[model samples]
Target: MNSSPPLSNLLRLAAAMIIITLSVYWMIFLRGLLVPILISVLLSILVSPITIQLEEKGLSKIASIILTIVLFLGLIAGIIYFATMQISDMLDVWPDLKRKGTLWFTQLQNWAYRLFGLRPQSQITKLQEMSMAFLSGGGSAALLKTTSTLADVILIPLYMFFMLYYRSFFCEFVYKVMAKSEKQRVNTVLFRICDVVHNYLSGLFIVMVIVGSLNTISLLILDINYAVFFGFFAALLLLIPYIGVLIGSLLPILMAFITKDSPMYGVGVAGAFLFIQFLEGNFITPYIVGSKISINPLVAIIGLLLGGVIWGIAGMMLSLPMIAILKVVFDHSESLKPFGYLIGEPVREESRRVVEEHTAENPELITDEVADSVKEAI
Candidate 1:
C-alpha cells in the first residue's frame, strides 16, 4: 500500500511535468501572435490614466482613447527622429571610423603575434570568411525579419485600440463569470494588476530618461563621438537585464580606443559608464521605480531566463513586470500567497521598521500570543 502511494505520487509528478512542457511549447509556438498582444496590453495600461483624464475633461471614450494613442505615437516618433539623426551623424563618419578601426585591429594583430605567437594572417582570413558568410546569408533573412516586425508594429496599435475600447466589457465579463464570493477578490486583483503595470511602465520610462540624460552628459564631458546616440542606446537596452549596460558601455569604449590617441581615454570611458551604472542600480532605479515592482533578484533573474527561452528579447523585457503582476495575483490568493512571498523582495526595511515600532508600543504583539499579527505586519 505504501509502494502504491509512492508510485501514485510519481505519476502525478510526471503528469505535472508533462503539462508544463506542453505549456512552454504552446507559448513558443504562439510567440508571434502573443508578443504584439502582450505589448498592446502593457501600452494600454500605461496610457489608461491619460484616457481617464481625457474622459474627465469631457472627451468621449472613443475620442479619448484615439487622442491618447495619437499622443503616444507622436512621442514614439519624436524619439525615433532623435535617434535617427544621431545615427545619420555616425553614418556620415562611418568611413573614417572604419579606417581607424582597421588600423587598430592591424596593430592588435601584430601585438598578439609578438606576445602569443598567433598568426595575424589567420585572424584576417577568419574575419574575411565570417564577413563573406554573413553577406551571403543575412540579406534575405534580414528583409524577411523586417517585414515580420513591420506587421507586428502595425498590429500592436490596432490591438491597443480594441483593448482600450473593450476594457469595460472585459471587466464586466470577468465579474459576470466569477462567483459572487470571489468577485470582490477578482476585482481587487484586477485593480492591483493594472496599478502594478501602470506604475512599473511609467516609472521605468522616467528612470530611462534620467539614466539616458546622465549617460549623455557624462559622454559629452568625455568628448566622445556619438555621445547622445550611445547614451540613449544604452538606456534603451536597459530593457534587457544584466548585460545591457555592459553592451552599451562597450561601444563608447571602442570608440575611445579607435578615435582617441590614448588608451587612457578608453579607460576613462569605462570608468564613467561603470559609475553611471552604479548610480542607476543603487540610487536611481530604487529611488525612482520604488518598491512597486519589488521582485527579488533571484526570482527576477530566473524569470528573465525563462522568458528569454520562451520568446527571446521581448520575453526578457516583459518577464519582470509579468512576474510582478503574477505576484500580486498570488498574494491575493489564499492557496498561492506563499508563492507570492517567495517572489517578493525579502524582509523589506520598511516592514522591519513597522515591526519594531509596533513591538515598542506593544511588545506582547511580537510574542507567541499574537504571532499571526507579527507575520501579517511583516
Candidate 2:
C-alpha cells in the first residue's frame, strides 16, 4: 500500500512536469505572434500610470492612450535616430577601423597562442565563414526575416495602444472571472503588481541615468571618443542581466585600445566599467529595483536563465517582471505562500510592514488576538 501511494505520487509529478514543459514549448513555438502581444502588455503596465494621470487631467481614454503611445514611440524614434547617426559615423571610418581591427586580431591570436598553445585563426575564419553564409546565402529566408521584423514593429505599437485603451475592460474581465469572495484579494494583488511594475520602471530609469552620467564623466576624464554614446550604451545593456555589463564594457575597451594613442586608456575603460558595475550591482540596483521587486540576485539570475531557456531573448526580458508577478500571486495564495516567501528577500520587517498595510487596508481581516500574535511574531 505504501509503495502504491508513492508510485502514484511519482506518476502524478511526472505528468505535471511533462504538461508544464509542453506548455512552455508551445508558447515558444507561438512566439512570433505572442511576443509582440506580451511586449505590449508589459509596455502598457509601464505606461499605465501616465495613462491614468492624463485621464485625470481631462483627457479621454482614447486621447490619453494615443498621447502615451506617441510619447513612447517618440522616445524609441529618438534612440533609433541616435543609433543611426552613430552607425553612419562608424561607417565613415570603416577602412581605418578595418585596419586597426586586423592589428587587434593578430594581437589576440598571439595572446591565445601564448596562453593556450592553440591557433585562433582557424576558429576565427570558421566563424567568419559561418556568419557570411547565414547573412548572404539567405534569399527568401532573409526576406521573410525582414518582413517579420517589420510586422512586429508595426504590431507591437498597435497592440500596446489597444491594450492601454482596453485596460479598464481587462480589469473588469478579471474581476468578473473571479468569485466575489476573492475579489478583494484579487484587487490587492492587482494593486501590488501595478505598484511593483511602476516603481521598478521608474527606479530603472533613474539608475540608467545615474549610471550613464557616471560613465560619461569617467570616460570624459579618460578622453574617450563618443563618450556619451558609449556611456549610455553600457547603461542600456544593463537591461540584460548577468553578462550584459561585460559585453558593453568590452566594446569601449576595444575602441579605447584601437583608437587611443596609449593602451593604458583601455585599462582605464575596463577599470571604469568594473567600478561602475560594482556600484550598480551592489548598491544602485539593490536599493532601487530590489525595493520594488524584493528579488535577490541569485533568484533573479536563475529565473532569467530559465526564462531564456524557455523563451529565448523575449523570455529573458520578461523573466524578472514575470517572477515578481508570480511572487505576488504566490504570496496571496495560502497554499503557495511558502514559495513566495522563499523567493522574497530575507527581511522580517518587510513582512511586518505588509501585515500593517494589510490591516490598514482590510481592518477586519484578523481578530484582536490574531493581531496581537502577529505583533509578537514581528
Candidate 3:
C-alpha cells in the first residue's frame, strides 16, 4: 500500500549525498591551509574585543595585532616554561616511580597469568608494536598518513595574525558580496557565529583555569608530589569531552597511589577530579558555555566520528565548534534549515516526538527511523 519515494525526492537525496561527500573530500584535501585559517579565525574572535579596545585607544591595526600576538605568545611561553620546570622535577624522581610501576606491573602480570592461564602478553605485544610503529614514523609522515592534512600546526599564529590584521577587510568584503537587502541577515549570522565561537573558546579556557586551580589546591592539601603538574594536565584534558574524563581522573589517581603511602590519597585524587567534572558539567558549563553549544549528543558523536575519519584526532577536537558554526549558518539560511535542525540538539518538540514514536514499536528497532523522520520533519 506504500508508494515508492518520489523521483524528485530521490534526486534531491542523491544530490545532497554527493555534495556532502565532495565537501568532506575538499576539507581533507585543503586542510593544510584551512586548518590554520580556521584556528586563526577562532583566535581572532576570542581576542577581538582586546584588539578593538586597543584600536579605540589609538593603536594602529597592525600594532594592535602585533601586541595581541605578542601577549598571546608570552602567555603560551610562560605556561610552557612552568610545565617544563614541573616535568624536570618529576623526571628527577622518575627512577623511583619506574621501580614502583615495574614491580606492580610484574605482580599483576604474574597473577593474571596464573588465574587466566591465557597469553595476554601476545595481545599486549601487538599493541606495543603498533604504538612503536606509529611513534617511529616521523610526526609529519604520521600526520600525513592519518589526516592527509598538513603536518605542521605551528603556523597557526601566523595565520591568526594576518587574519586579525585583515579582519576588517574581510568583513567589508563579506558585506560587499551580499545584496543590501540581505545585509541584516548576514550581519545577524556573523554576530551569532562570533559570539558562539568567542564565548565557547573563552569560557572553556576560563573553566580550565578555575578547575585547574581547584585541583591544584586540593592536591596541595593532600601533599601530593607534582600536584600542579597533574592538576593542570588533568584540567586541560576536559577539553576532549568523554575520553578526557577517564584519562584525567586516571592520571592523578595513579600519581597519588604511587607517591603517597595511603590508598585514601588515591581515592581523594579520583574523587576530586570526578567531583570537579560533575560540577563543571552540571553547573559551571551551563552558566559559561551553555546554550551556545547546545548540540545534542547524537549530532556531536556523529561529528566526532566523521571528523576522525577526515582529520583524525585534531578533527575530533574541532568537530563540536565546527558543528556549532554550521548550526548558526543553517539557522539563518532558508534552504539549509533542515540541516540545522538535523545537526542540532533536540531541544523541545523534536526530542519528545522522537521518544513517542520510538516507543510505539520495538523502541530499539525504531530509533534510527525516528531520527530520520525528525530530520525530514524539519
Candidate 4:
C-alpha cells in the first residue's frame, strides 16, 4: 500500500553515489604520481595491435614492444628538441615583442580616449600597480611551483617504462581473477574498452599530425617566425579536446602579434586553425574513429571541467576515456543500460533492427542476453 520508494534501495543508491564521488576525488588528488603511468598503460594498450602484428611477423614480443617504445620516445624527443630550438629563437626577439606590445596598448588607449573621453592612462597605471603587487606577493611561489611541475614531467618517461614492461602480465591477471561465468563478460567489456580508447587515440594522433604539418607549412608560407614551435604547440593542444585548439591557436597569434607588429598574421593563423578544425570535426574524426564511442558534447565538457578541477592536466586527458569505459560497462549491464543509452551517441533504429535480425538468425547469441538481462534487471 506504500507509494514511497523503498528505504533500502534509497540507502544503497546513496552509498553507491558516495563511493563513486570519493573514488573520483581520490584519483584526482592522491593519484597524481600514478597518472603518467596510467596514461602510458592506456596508450600502450591502444597501440598493442601494432606490437602484436610485429610479433606475428616473427619478431619477439619484447622486441616489438621495444620498437614501439623507441618510436614513441624518438617522436617525443624530436618534438622537444624542435620546440626548444624554436623557442630559444623566439625568446631572442622578446625585447622587440615587448616594444610592439607597448605600442599596441598605447594606440588602443589613444583610440579609447578619443572615442569615450575616458582616461586610458589611469587604467594602465592601475594594471601596472596590480602586476607589481602580484609579482611581489606570489611570484616567487609561482616559480617554485613551475620547478615542481618540471620535475613531474621528468618522471613521466620513467613511469612509462615500468608500465609498458608489465602491461601483459597485468591484463592476464585481471582476466584470471574473474569467476568462470563472469569471465567472458568481463573480457568482452575490457576488450571493447581497449578498442574504444585505442581507436580514439590513434585517430587523434593521425589528426594532430595532419593538423600540425599543415599549420607549420602555412606559417612557413606566411613567413611567420617560430613556425615549427607554434605548429608543435598546436598539435599538443589537440590532445585536450574542444578547448585545446583555441588555446593552441592563441599562442601563435600572440607570437605573430609580437614579432610582426601586424594583425594580419594573427588573422591568417586563426583562419587556418578554423579550417583545419572544421575538416577534422566534420570528416576526419567521424570517418576514422567512427561512432563506436560517441559521447555527448555536454557530458564531455562537464567531464573535462571536473577532471581539470580534480586531477589537473592528467585528469582532463583521461576524462573522456574513463567516461567511455563507464558507458561500455553500463551498456552491458541490464539495470544500467538506460543510463548508457543516455550517454551514448544516438542509435539508429535500422541498425538496431539489423542487429536483432542477426541475433535471431543465431539463437546462441541471445542465450546470455535474456538470462543476464532478466537477472540483472530484477
Candidate 5:
C-alpha cells in the first residue's frame, strides 16, 4: 500500500502559522504609529452624533467637527494641568511618603511574623537589597520609559485632529466600495457596531466620571494627599473592563496606605471602589448600555488577554470594542453566525416565536389600535 504524502500538508500548515505570526507581530510593531490614529478615529466615531446634531442646529459640518476637536483638546489640557499639579505635590512629599511606607511595611512584617511564627527581619533585609538593586538599574530605565511616553503624548492629539477631520470621507469610502447585496449587510453591521461602541464608550465615560468624582470626594473627606491624581488615574483605568477596576482600586488604596497613616483608610478606599463598581455594573451599565452588545464573559476575558499580548496597554484598552465589532460581523454573516452565537448572549428563540404567533392571532394587536393591550399582555 502507498503511503499518503505528508510533506505538502506539513508545508502548508507551517506557511499558515508563519503568516499568522507575522500578522500579529506586524500589528504589535506598528501599534506605536497606528494606535493614536485608531484611538482618534474611534473617538471621532463616538462623538460624531454630537457633531451631526450641532450641524443640524446651524453650524457647518466642518465647523462643528472643528469645534468638537477644540473642546476635547481643551478638556484634555485641563486634565493634564490638574493631574500635573497634583503629581508635583505628591513628588514634593516623596521622601516623607517613602519613610512612612517603610514604617508601614515593617509593622506589617512584624504582624505577619507574630501571626505565622516566621522570621520577619530576614525578609525585610531581602526586600531592602532588592529595592537597592532596582534603584540602581530599574529607576533609570523607568525614567527613560517616562521620557518615551511623554513623546507619544505630544503625537496623539495631532493624530486625533487629522483623523477627526477625515472621518466623513473614510465612512463614505467604506459604504461606496461594497456590492449591492453586500452593501446593505455591511451598512447594517457597521451601523450596529458604531451604535454599540458609541453607547458603551459614552456610558463608560459617564460612569467613570461619577466614580472618579466619588473617589475624590471620599479621599478629600479622609484628608488624603494626591486625591485628585488618584481619582483621575482611576477614571482613566475604568475604560478597561474587570481588570481595570482592580487596578484603579488598588492604586488609590495603596496611596491611602502610604499617605493617610492608617490601614483602615486603605480598606475604606477599597470598599468604596467595590461599592461603586457594584452599582455601576448592576444599575448604570444596564440602564444606559442595555442589552445591545452582550458577549460571553469567557470570550471577553480571552480577547482582553490576547489583545494585551498583541499590543500592550492600547491593545488592552481597545480589546472589548474590537471584539464587539467582530462579534457584530460574525453575527450577521451566514458562515460565521455559529461563532457569533457562541460569543453572544443567550436568547430564547421559542419565546420570540410564541410572541410572534400571539401578535398574528390578534389583528388589532399588530396595529397601533391595540398597542396598549399588547404592551399589557407582554
Candidate 6:
C-alpha cells in the first residue's frame, strides 16, 4: 500500500520553508548592520591565535587584542598604500594608455567592418551612448555606495576588538543557554568551529600569496606593465572565489590588447590567467588550503549566488566561510545533521566502511566524543 506523508511532517516542512524565507528577508533588510558584525566575527576568529600567543607571553587579554588589531591594521594599510601608489602611477600614464587604446579600437573597428559590414562610426556612437547612459545613471549611486563601504570598514576594527575582548562572555552565555548534559558537546562544537575557521582562513591567505607570486612572475616574464599590481590585484580578488579571478584578469588583458602592437599579447594574458586558475583549483588550493571546510561544489555555487544577492561582493566573499560555520552548527544538532551533510562533500564508501568497522569494534563509540573523532578522521 502507498502512504502519504504525515500531516505533521508536511506542516513542519512548510514552517521551515516559511522561516527560511523570513530569515533571508531579515538578512537583506539588515545587510549594512549585519555585514560588519559578521566580518568582525570572522576576523576575530582568524586572529585569535595571535591574541592567545600574546596572552601566553604575560600580556593582559586587552593588551594582546589591541596589539593584534594594530598589527592587522598595519598590514592592511601597507597593502592599501602600495595599491594606491600603483593606481597613481597608472593614472600618470592614463593619457598614453587612452591614446593607445583608441588606436587599437580603431583597428578593431576596421576588422569588424571588413568581416561583418559594420560601420565604425555607428559602433563608436553606440559605445558613447551606452557609456553616457551608464555614467549618468550610476555616478551618484556609486558615490553613496563607496561612502557606505568606508563607514563599514571603519566600524570593523571596533567590532573586532569588542568581539575578541568578550569572547569568554559569549562562550559562557552559550554554555548557560544549553542543557548541562549537552555542555561538553557544545564546547567541542565551538572549538571545532574556531579551529576550522582559523585553518581555512590562514591556509587561504597562504594560497593567495602563492598564486599572486605565480601571477606576478608570469606577467614579469611577459614584460607586462605594473605586473606586481595586476598580479596581486587578481590574487586579492580570489576572495570572491570562482568568478573573481576572471574579473581581475580583465584589466591586464585590456592593457595588453591596447599597449602591445598585436592582439596576441591579450590572448597570451588570457591564457596565462586561465592556466593559473587551473593550477589554483587543482593543485595549489588542494595542497595548501586542503578540505577543511569540506563544502561540495553545488552548495558553494548556490551560496555564492545567494550571498551576492543579499550583500553583493562582500557577501560573495563571506559566503563559503559562513556556510562552513553553518555546517558545523548543523552537524552538532541531531535534527540538523542531515542539512549539514547535504551541504558537505559526499562521503566515500571506504570512509563509511571504516566508520562501520569502528562502531562494530566498540559499540559504545557511537557518542559525541567518538563521533567527532571519526568525523575528524574522515
Q: Work out the TM-score per prediction.
A: 0.89, 0.85, 0.82, 0.83, 0.80, 0.92
Better of 1 and 2 by lDDT: 1
Which of 1 and 5 is ahead in lDDT?
1
What does candidate 5 score on TM? Answer: 0.80
Q: What is the lDDT, from 0 to 100, of the residue 127 in candidate 3? A: 66
Cα-based lDDT at residue 279, candidate 5: 76
List where candidate 2 sits over 4 angstroms from the true fold: 1-8, 111-146, 347-378
Candidates in descending TM-score order: 6, 1, 2, 4, 3, 5
Show where candidate 4 strays beyond 4 Å. 53-64, 115-118, 129-151, 347-354, 357-378
CA-RMSD of model 3? 8.6
Model 3 misplaced stretches (Cα beyond 4 Å)? 118-154, 262-264, 348-378
TM-score of 4: 0.83
TM-score of 1: 0.89
Model 4's C-alpha root-mean-square deviation from the true structure amounts to 5.3
* Candidate 5 lDDT over residue span 274-359, tens digit each: 88778767887666654556777788888889888887777888888888888878878888888887776554323334666777
Q: After superposition, how far is residue 377 of candidate 6 from its true place, in Å?
A: 5.5
After superposition on all C-alphas, the RMSD of every candidate to the true structure, in Å, is: 4.2, 4.6, 8.6, 5.3, 4.9, 2.8
lDDT by residue (tens digit), candidate 1, 1-378: 344567878898999899999999999999989988999999999998999999999999999999999999999899899989988888899999999999988888999999988899888898899988987985547777678789998899899889999999989988887766487789888998998899888988988888889998988998999888899899888888766888888898999999988888899989988998999899888776655677888999999999998988889999988899899888888888788878888766357456657877987647855654664344
In candidate 2, what are the lDDT values of residues 296-346, reduced to their tens digit?
567888989987886666678778888888888887888888888778776
Over the full model, what C-alpha lDDT does candidate 5 score relative to the true structure?
0.76
* Candidate no. 6 TM-score: 0.92
Identify the runs in model 6 with alpha carbons over 4 angstroms from their true place: 1-4, 132-140, 347-353, 356-359, 362-377
Where does model 5 exceed 4 Å of error?
1-19, 57-62, 116-121, 128-148, 220-223, 259-262, 347-378
Q: Residue pairs in steric clash, candidate 1?
A: none
lDDT (CA) per prediction: 0.86, 0.83, 0.79, 0.76, 0.76, 0.89
